[model samples]
Target: MRDRIFRRGILPIAVVAALSAVAGCSASGDTDSPKGSAAPSGSRAGRVDPRSAAALRAVEQATVRAGSARIESSTAMGGMLSLKTDGALGWSGDQVGTLRITYTGGQLAATMRALSGASMEARLLPDAYYAKVGDTFARRLNGRHWIRYGYGDLATLPGGSGAYLTDQLRTTAPLQPVRLLRACGDVRRVGEETVRGRRTTHYSGTVTPAALTGEDAAGLRKQLEQAGVATETVDIWVDDRGLLVKKAEQGELVGGRMSATAYYRDYGVQVSAARPPAADTADFKELMSTRGS
Candidate 1:
């Protein structure tokens, strides 16, 4: 890639595109991006069953109580971008973790290839996140191997991607999907199914912007409204212990169709993501400055 194109803002645009698709995930170490839309599986919100509501409430509580988990997820944005991520996240309070993100296909894949080959490490923290850049790309970044995306800086993003920064910061916790499902209110038990050899109870529901609860609800509401997404399908499978075992969400965006599936295991696992070396890190906004990028 030409230095001028990159400095002219290619990387940030790519980051924004990837962020909008994932809703709040960072391109590198900040892979805790938590929600993806799915096909609607049950009745509308107005007629929720008492049994289903109670069960869902249990899941929400159990998941949050677990505190942390190992996560493997895949996300796709229509024909634009697709990726797989495996990471550990902790959310007893502020979300924190690290993920290995691999670009599998779509428009963003090419840019990621130029930036960091197929995959790179992402470290998520409470106040900011970091993405690892490849060696050659690091040279362009003045030998900095890490890019820091401060939570506050996210608001300056050019488009809708900026709107979900708060959600990502607040909801990218391991238990976010279950929290969203419980908050949705209109849901049903989709029966029990086996997941990776374990028996699990499945639940499905619709997530409308208005039904959104938890971190950054207003921002997410506006994001869906701006995207013209009236409703999206969300499905979750919970093990007998009330812990979420798998989650799938599918929805539409202004750019194209988007979907994500995530699997969770090893709850109560201790996870940590120490910040990268300050000497080797560059703030994202620093790259946008009128200085040598």
Candidate 2:
């Protein structure tokens, strides 16, 4: 198995330099935000008021609109990475990766993946992804051959993607708390700052049951951690237009640290309600069994 970190479209040196600014430590819980909130089993969404409800609804709409645009995002990761179990893995220090997404009028058409950890590049076509490590290559078959691939899940093909992130940003009804206050429950302003040159609206609140148990949130965590992972803090950042500009999570898992960050750009496209192909049901069952074993 060949697994390594990758980078694209930017200087590896510069990317590393940029990532160096981020501390090599985990962010502690901030009670002011929902990320620090804990979830209990068998819970339902709490009652939210009208004004806060409108704010959340507007935020959700803006997020969907932003996701409708093409985007390019870069991330720098550092950790004791174990690519495979039983010690085939070694440690990877501060490494950087860049992902590029091509969308035509808000529909994802292509994805380019590059990682510096192992020097790999992969291109994803609609239903399949071609991965190349130097002159060697492998093919990952995506079951969905009809619907196009989303950028969120594109660059991280077979693992996670920009498309997956976009889907999460597109929420409706009770699932969309940022859109309606009654759906959002309690809210607190977490102050504001500029991101990528855009003035943004920043608010942090406790995670409601609807927030925690929702399919999108659960799917996001489950899909990212198919191999069993632990992470801390799920943050949602909205821009001035009330759109979610970024979503980030940071945490430690398996003896190594792991993280996933996504940015929403270019909004206003109609998306299909398609889902990422499920990992093999048998494999999933076996994974659960082994975890218990």
Candidate 3:
């Protein structure tokens, strides 16, 4: 039981990462090539108030044009876990970046404490995201220090956030919040506010799989429904330049309550993420196969 602490604790906690943010664990080039990018959820969508809709459109275009940003975010999924991520993410190309993920508290944090204490490194790419869980993981997984989760492979998991995170990562560009808000059809400006000392405009809206439209609405709706997300409240702050500066989302999943807040800065910044050495990494799919065998 003592020896299995780290290994056994990874899956559920990783899923929470996905649920709380557009991040999570798993990867490997050694497995069959992962499937394709995931499809997002959506609903029927509301008829937007023309003016508000146009404003949000500008935010989306401007944000997507910027390409990348530095992020500091925190998430708490009810009582399951609480974590903070400090990293940079790039969407100019395929998603590529790195984040220092720290489990601050909650049940999962205690399990993680048994391995790397409380923090880990997540390397993200378009194809997979690798979790570096320290040397203990290396020794346990045949000298592999990293675990690779391929998006395509994650999609095959029946009830895991593997697929959800993949799909979100593919779609969760800095401009994504604007697009989702546009789908709300009733997005409203909540007056001006100051974030991190910068003046900004705040917008609030409610979104559900059944009311989301635009882009891949139907597909996302189904995916979200499968994951038990009935409705979600979204709030975003946009700077004078129409760039998204921050966003907060709250909702309930099949597991419990989930909430995440992320701040974006230094748009157009350079972000780099290099894949780890293959010999030092284990693919979750292959690991499962080995255990099954």
* TM-score of candidate 3 on Cα atoms, chains taken together: 0.84
Quick one: best TM-score, which candidate?
Answer: 3
Ranking by TM-score: 3, 1, 2
TM-score of each: 0.84, 0.42, 0.84
- Full-model lDDT for every candidate: 0.67, 0.32, 0.66
- Over the stretch 198-241, how does candidate 1's per-residue lDDT look in tens digits? 99887777777777765646655665575556666667778999
lDDT for residue 147 in candidate 3, whole number 0-100: 81
- Could you tell me which residue pairs clash in candidate 1? 28-122, 29-122, 29-123, 37-249, 37-250, 38-233, 38-249, 38-250
Q: Write the per-residue lDDT of candidate 2 for residues 57-121, one digit (tens) a residue.
A: 67655543343432233222233211110000001211112222211211111121222223333
- Candidate 3: tens digits of C-alpha lDDT, residues 146-182: 8888777665454455555556556545555566577
Report the number of backbone clashes for model 2. 32
